[model samples]
Target: MVPYIRAQNVNLTFRPKNRDPVTALQGLSLEVGRGEFLSLVGPSGCGKSTFLNVLLGLLRPDQGEIHLDGKKISGPGYERAMVFQEFGLLPWRTVLANVELGMELKGVPASIRRERASELINLVGLTGFEHHYPHELSGGMKQRVGLARALATDPEVLLMDEPFAALDAQTRDLMQAELLQIWDRTKKTVIFVTHSIEEAAYLSDRVVVVTSRPGRAKKLIDIKLPRPRDYEMRLTPEFNDIKATIWNSLKDELISRGIGDGR
Candidate 1:
């Protein structure tokens, strides 16, 4: 089957004022199959986030081509939406208003936008808190609102960048479970960026490991376990095995970068 998202020979670089150029991604390539859950993980400054941005069309690679559903990707399109680690919600807007913003930008009729936003709010389990402002919501709730906002556009692909990184351990685990539930319900192709081996193993159909800075694909590990995954499955031997393999594979690269043992 043709991949829903494809990136070929991708290269990205940047030059900041009074500094040598930084190579964010060097000849990185990736593909995401239809309805697949793919996770990209690497050490800090390894360009995992850059890959997500490139796929979302938020950043143009200096080299390489990206395609969505077999069409060339030139700029940001409604078929792709993103959720960031920071939530990126408008502080002044209520949950409903924030979720409705995307529809409004797309010129969707106000009434229809309201209806669609309401449905997505409920889907993300924020029905009763639609009127609450961002500040009044907890971190997990804010991220949920961000996810709802992304889903409101009916995107074919969802790009998440370490969205659970900021949450406490307990909240992060809860959000991870919630994210899997949401993905099962939505069936949207998802490309997630994370640093945790455990998170990638638990949440993805495939995990794409990358080398350190000037990143390149190091390996792809298939996660064949059944879906509707929950805490019970996380305790199984299979899960630990997968996590161990990833740790062994990535430990060397992380060490080479002087971030040995992720300390």
Candidate 2:
């Protein structure tokens, strides 16, 4: 079967008047299988987010093409949902209302939207806080709200750009486990971008490493760890082995960028 998402010979160039053109991605190509959890890892400014924006149709590439489920993609659709690092919830809306925002935009019926929002709120462990506003919640809770909103649309592809980067370490781990559970239940195609080796290893079926700026694929590593994974999985030597492998790959790239001084 054709890959669910594919990018071929993609390059993006940004040119400001009188300045040399900045190349964000150079001949970057990748394919994500249907229902697979794929993680993209790279050093800062390696155009990981730019690649996502391209998938979202927020930016146009200078060359090549992107396709979803074997068809060329031209714009964003409700079939794709994004969860931003900064919990993009409206402070004024209650948790339930925030989760329903997407359905509301899509003109879903009021009763059906409310029912779906309630189910998602409970699914993300925010059941009792449905009436609470963003300002009333903790950082982790706010992120949960963001997750519920993203899942509410039942999107075929979930694009997460460091969605847990802002959380504390403990909370981040918990969220990762929660995310895996949700992914298993929904079997959605997920593209998670992160700088954390352990996070990528624990959460993804495949991890794609990219070079520094003017990003291109360096290697794509397959994660063989079994599912129903939890905190105990992190304690196993197998988990650390995967983490170390990714760290080593990342170290070389960082050194080439002059940011690997072991500071």
Candidate 3:
């Protein structure tokens, strides 16, 4: 059977004026099952975000192809929605308006959009804050808004580029747990790009590690931990074992690039 999402032998290169071409992805491939939460973890320049862009149809790969449910991804479509690291909210818009933005753009009826946005706002734990503006909220709250906006359209797949990276440690932890609850409830296929090994282990069904620049898939590690996970799970031997496996796969790329001594 065909996979829900498939990226085969993908490659991309960037050409800047008066500079040598840089390849971001080469021979990188992956398949994500429907409703699966997948994470990509690699060194800083390893094209994790680049791959996410490809999935979002933001950047066309120079070679190879990516498909969703057997359809080639040629450009942006409502079937996919992205949550950027930066909260890409309109500063002047209220949380409810921001969440409704995508559905509004898609020509969803005003009444329906407003109703859907309200439900999503509550889902993300921002029920009362729907009237609040971006500046009025904390980093975590803003991210919740972004997440709600991404989901308002009811996209089949969600692409997240280090969505929690900017939050403080405690908030990040809280958001991680919140995200799992949301995912369990929504069941949208997710492709998340994060540099944190622990974060990847905690959030994904399978974590894909890519090699350094001109990135390619290096290894895929499956998380065997049972779900309905809580913070206490992070302290379990199983979780740490998963972390160690991801670290082992990632450290080789870092050491090869001289970023670490592999200690």
Candidate 4:
């Protein structure tokens, strides 16, 4: 089957003011299957986030191409939507109000936007909190609002960047379960960027490991675990085995960068 999203020989570089140039990505290529849950994991500055941004069309790569459903992606389209770690919600708006903002900007009618937002709000498990503002919600709640807003567009792909990183461990676990449930329901192709090997193993059908600095694909590990994954699965040997493989992939890159063990 043809890949749903394909990146070929991608390269991107930047020059900071009063500093030498830096390459963020080099000869990086990736292909994500339709309806697949894929995660990109790497150490800091591995271009994981940059890859997501390129796919989002917020940044243009200096070279190479990205395609979606066989069509070249020159710019951002409605087929893609993103959820960030910071929970980018308007403090002044209520939950439903924030969720409706995207469609509202697209000129969706009030009644229609309200209807769709209401459904998604419930889908993300924030029914009674529709009237609550961002400040009133907890960190996890705020991130849920962000996810609801991203999905409100009914986009074909959902791009998440360490969105659960800011939450407490318990909340992060809860959100991870919630994310899997939501993905099962929606089955939207997802490209997630995370630093945690455990998170990648628990959430993805496959994990893509990227090398350090001027990142390129180092390895791809197929998560053979069964679907409908939950917190308990982490305790099993199978899960840890996958985690070990990913850890080794990351460890090799880190060691090469002189970030050796024993601090």
Candidate 5:
């Protein structure tokens, strides 16, 4: 079967009138099977977020194209949703209202939207906090709100751009486990972008490593760990080995970018 999401010969460059253009992605090609959890990892300039935006139709590639469910992705659709690293919450809105924002935008009726919102709020572990506002919650709680809001639409593809980057280490781990559980129940296609090797390994079915500036797919590794994973799985030698492999590839990418001293 054709891959659920596919990108071929994609290239993107950002030009500032006064300075030379910087190429973010170059000839990058990838495929994510339906319901697959794929992670992208690399140094700072690899265009992981750019690729995510491209899939979201926020940015168009200069060359090649992106396809979802075997069709070209020309613009953003409710079928694809994004969770930003910043949480993107409206401080004035209560947790339930925030989660219902997408449904509200889609013209969903009040009664139905409220029901869905309540279900998602509970799914993300924010049941009692539905009446709470963003400022009233912790960072992790805020992120759970973001996650619920993203899933509120029941999108087929979930694009996450370092969604847990702002959380504390302990909370990040807990969120990862929670995310896997959510994925288990929903079985949506997930494309996650992150800077953490361990995070990628712990959460993805396959991890894509990209090169430095003008990034391209360097290598893709399959994660063979069992499902229903938890923090304890992170301590196993298998997990560390996967992390180390990605780290080695990432280290080379950083060194090539001249950001890391070989010392």
Candidate 6:
């Protein structure tokens, strides 16, 4: 069977006027199985988020192609949605209204969208805060609203670009566990871009480490850790081993780019 998502020899370049062109991705290829949670990690500016935008159809590749299921992706479709690191909630809208935004744009009726939004609001653990606006909520709560909004459209694939990176350490960890729970229940095919090696190890079924600049897949490591994961699991030797493996791969990329010492 064909992979649920495939990127073959994908390349993209940024050609800002009067400046030298920067290649974001070069010959980056990978295949994701249906309902798989895949994370991309590498040195900063390695095009992980750029690749996510490509998958979202926000940017067209200069070469190669990406296919969803058996269809080639030419532009953004309702089948995919993204959650950003900065909570992309509208300050003017309440939690419920924001969650309803996607479905609303898709022409879903108020009654139906309201019901679905309510359910998702609850799913993201923001049930009673429906009336609250973005300003009234904490960083984590705003992210929950963003997550709920992303799911409001019922997309088959979810693209997350460091959705919890802004939160405090404790909140980030809590959100990670919450996100896994949501993923378990929804089973959405997720392509997450995160710089945290531990976060990638904890959340992904497979972690893809890319090379720096003109990013390409450097290593694809499978995490064999059991699911229904908890903080206690982080203390296990297996978890640390996985983190170490990913770090070593990413470390090599950084060292190659003169970003850090191997030590």
Candidate 4 per-residue lDDT, tens place, 93-193, comes to 99999999889877889999999999999998899999998999999999999999999988999999999999999999999999999999999999999
Error of 3 at 70 (Å): 0.7
Q: Write the per-residue lDDT of candidate 3 for residues 216-236, one digit (tens) a residue.
A: 999999998899888999999
lDDT of 2 by residue, 1-263 (tens): 78788999899998989999889999999999999999999998899988988887888999999999878878878888888888989998999999999999999999999999999999999989999999999888998999899899889999998999999999998899899999999999999999888899999999999999899888999999988888899899999999888888888889989888642
Error of 5 at 182 (Å): 0.5
Clashes of 5: 0
Model 4 Cα shift for residue 257 (angstroms): 2.7
Task: Give all candidates' CA lDDT scores.
Answer: 0.91, 0.91, 0.93, 0.92, 0.92, 0.94
Model 3 lDDT, residue 43, Cα: 88
Query: Which residue pairs come into collision in candidate 4?
Result: none
lDDT of 6 by residue, 1-263 (tens): 89999999999999999999999999999999999999999888989999999999999999999999989999989999999889889999999999999999999999999999999999999889999999999999999999999999999999999998899999999999999999999999999999899999999999999999999998999999989899999999989899999998888789878987643
Question: What TM-score, computed on C-alpha atoms, does each candidate reach?
Answer: 0.97, 0.95, 0.97, 0.97, 0.96, 0.98
Q: Against the hidden true structure, what lDDT does model 2 obtain?
A: 0.91
* Residue pairs in collision within model 6: none
- Over 4 Å off, model 3: 261-263
Q: Model 6: runs farther than 4 Å from truth?
A: 261-263
Q: What is the lDDT of residue 105 in candidate 6?
A: 91
Candidate 2 deviant stretches above 4 angstroms: 16-20, 261-263
